[model samples]
Target chain A: MARRPLQEINAGSMADIAFLLLIFFLVTTTMDQDIGILRQLPPPVPEDLETPPVKKRNVYEVLVNSRNQLLVEGERMDIADLKEGAKMFYTNPNKDPDLPILTRQTRGAVEENITLLQQALVKDPKNKQLETDLKKWKGKLSAIELIGEYDELPTSALISLQNDRGTKYAMYISVQNELSAAINELRNELAQDKFGVAYSELNPSVAEDKPKIKAIRAVYPQRISEAEPKDISGN
Target chain B: MSKFTRKGKKGTPAVSTASLPDIIFMLLFFFMVVTVMRQDDPKVSISKPNATETEKLEKKSLVDYINVGTPIDTRFGTEPKIQLDDAFAEVVDIQFWIKENRDRRDEAEKPLITTSLKVDSDVKMGVVTDIKQELREAQALKINYSVNKGSALDNN
Candidate 1:
């Protein structure tokens, strides 16, 4: 009365099982790569506060309408040419001799003026005379200095973007991307010229060259100021 | 002739399957490594606009997505809706969502959180602007507009 030995289960079918699972995953899996234009939103303005006026020459105004038309600096522009136009406007390499030079001294004077105005306002919050003077000095300090003698620094070049409320989100984002590209393009060019390195490689993670990269960024900072959306009819 | 026929007649000796599991295992690992389990199944239809100047989102963990488009489900109707995580949300819900996401991160990593807006290209700018304002109110200043590469969209 001998009992038959138990038969070993086949391992051969394991491959088939694995293949089935693999195929299932292959069918369901998606390898989507996320990519996009990065931007920082400006701080919310207080209801009672006023946005200081930007001198016409210093502002690189870009407008997008509901139809996705681009109006750059009051001229109808094609979306394809936006990057080059923005770059030229911001760099202004061919200085206009009539424009005032934005030197270290001028910046210092502007800062001093602002501080004095702030102190005066604090002392006499309700004084009409001080308030008027404060507003004037504030405008001067915040003015975009367009110097003909030197290349316009990024700090003084302001990009003002406005869009119609009905503008497509795509167009609005595209414009922003182009403007950012202009700034980044300038920074990369400067980085390559000065440090012989690509701008992306000049990041702070590259500890040895961080300072040099920081200097280059300072020369070509991104200064996009998004204005409130205007009514489509106005555009 | 008969001896030569016997050698050829062995009939391929039952093709060895011993290594079949190993080969399958290798394939399994390959798929596992390449697969990115989607965190959220988009309920809304999204066709991102093409753009020339896009950078690959470097840190995946630091990004939280907000999808804006008309819902795919008929139940939700045709009006454009914002999808945050798993559910439909209003623009105002963005503030709390951002705060919750930020709080979940380590203190040092919280500042690096970026709100990735995956808005359908056809959606009006007004909706996106509202979301941006909400994000600003929540102090989530870093934002990324998700876009496909121009060439990729063209190929499609």
Candidate 2:
């Protein structure tokens, strides 16, 4: 027996329902953002505050050549080291949340260090003498080294620059300048955070520490080639 | 014709709206579970760039992050890996985290509607763009790469 024509179901309410549902989802569904760790950089107070060490503190020497063989400190560090340092940086330790001013002050010093490093490296034609000096310390050619002695090193942030074969000395400066600018800006922004503590006395102010800020350099590979140890002597 | 019997479709069942109410109810339920039930992953707070115009948002432990900072040279120089906090993450690591977190939320039927990226203030524009490019490709393009808006003292 043929089934009676399925009653032509009229579900006009589907439209109202759909529209209502759309509005409901659109309205009630909170598409709010998940904020990351960010706090304001408060103004500096006079007293030396008890500060927490930077939570993400790992110093890495990032050396980039024309060939893009990256280096850490004096040694040729592969990509793996980069990850470790970055992660270690994150794990260094969270600053005590109270000392916002301290965070700002220290960050300023790092900013200067980064800025100076950028300036030194990005200069056109590059200062050959300085690159040479930096390299002499690196170890003369024949050594694909990865590190330098860590005893009592300068506290400044350093970014050494060297170029690959056939690269213009100008390229060395260009890279240095670009990298420096980026890093300094970041430093400044970060320093303004609310989480840091000053472990030391506020004897030296950020303003006073300007010229004494950390140092950054642009070392040419040809120059660094000299610093490369005699593979046998160093290894 | 028999008096044109009513075709207004059962007077809309007085249920107001269907389908969507069910869908929204389901979604609301899903998020409520996420915000309350799911084991919140450990969160590492980067020194986020503060913004004066910014509002206090509900902090999410499940943030999709792109670490735009100096990657560590773990073995000094032998192996360079990008660490998402202490986790030795690769570019693929970022990709995996992005995908994994998003997927985890998605599986629970709560697709991540947004993301946060921590780029060091000194990070380059190109680097930020590169990360953004990756996020876009991953379809987690809706993101908030934190930046220092202005000193809080700016207004005062």
Candidate 3:
């Protein structure tokens, strides 16, 4: 407001200020991450398989009370050999390899898994929840029973087990993470083969332990089930 | 008009930024303290598994919550009647919720449904899975599991 000649604002100073602001923002900006499943969003669900997507109808309810009593198919699973039986749920002798992975575990693997579980319970007897956890783990094991050849099987069959809401979330989440891992494994293994089920991959230390190829994906109700060719094509 | 001052050369534009770090730090601290963290706490206990891929998110739209009280009115009634957070309920309810959410969005926008499952840390696996299965069955556009800071603070 001074009654004197005004000096023009230098354009050079403005350019310098702009560059500084640009650098500041560039240095501090965070990357855009995918917090949850980031899909194209109109919908991510693909069409259901020509074969009806396995519904929740086949879920076998396994209940474990706070006391750790295991129930499978509505009967008490012998705590001593529950794993052995679960393995048998997945593996049937000399039938079509065309069978589902949800029903193809071996009697021996089931036994070994049960023994390991029993050992865990025996080692950690103070915690009553361990036994309950061991019971639910069986279904996950059945779905992800990895074979000697590192081949994997289809575990698309949804298995629902019920535990008390009062139970620790850790126990449930671990079981779920295990199931997701198994399902992920099953999908990766089958992605390469035809007719789906393949041997479970064993660890590279032993070729039998290497991960098998997986090929199955999950489908739930409520979402439109249009066949997205990609889901069916890659396999 | 001809007065000379020793500080005449101090009028550099860069001088303004001398205190920029402190000013910015103070403002950031002010917001950090004054602004209540818009956290999505179900006020229920939730146990989240450790995953390297997990990330913290800012405001997410109406994600579902589960507060595990004594399970009552649950499908697993024979086990015991303890109040359950929505996590242990049937798949159908979750599907219904998702469809409702999807339908409520703006017509021109791509229906982006972000179904979040926040179960108490001690909730049952069967219950959690059932909820997830329901969301999946509902054909959720995208689903994410939320972890509580209290649980996450443990390892650190």
TM-scores of all candidate predictions against the true structure: 0.78, 0.26, 0.37
Give the best candidate by DockQ.
Answer: 1
Write the residue-wise lDDT of candidate 2 on A146-224 in tens digits.
1111112122322323333322222222333334333433333332321132212112357643221221111111011
How good is the docking of model 2, as DockQ?
A: 0.04
Interface RMSD in angstroms for candidate 1:
3.1
Instruction: Please give the ranking of all candidate structures by DockQ, highest first, separated by commas.
Output: 1, 3, 2
Q: Which candidate leads the pack in lDDT?
A: 1
Angstrom error at residue A189, model 2: 28
Please give the DockQ score of every candidate, comma-separated: 0.45, 0.04, 0.15
**Could you give the DockQ of candidate 3?**
0.15
- Between candidates 1 and 2, the one scoring higher on lDDT is 1
List the pairs of residues colliding in candidate 1: none
Best by TM-score: 1
Q: Candidate 3 lDDT, tens digit per residue, A58-115?
A: 4434454543345655778643343333333333234433333334345466567778
Judge the docking of candidate 1 as incorrect, acceptable, medium or high. Answer: acceptable
Please give, as one word, the docking class of candidate 3: incorrect
Worst 10 residues of 1 chain A by lDDT: A143-152
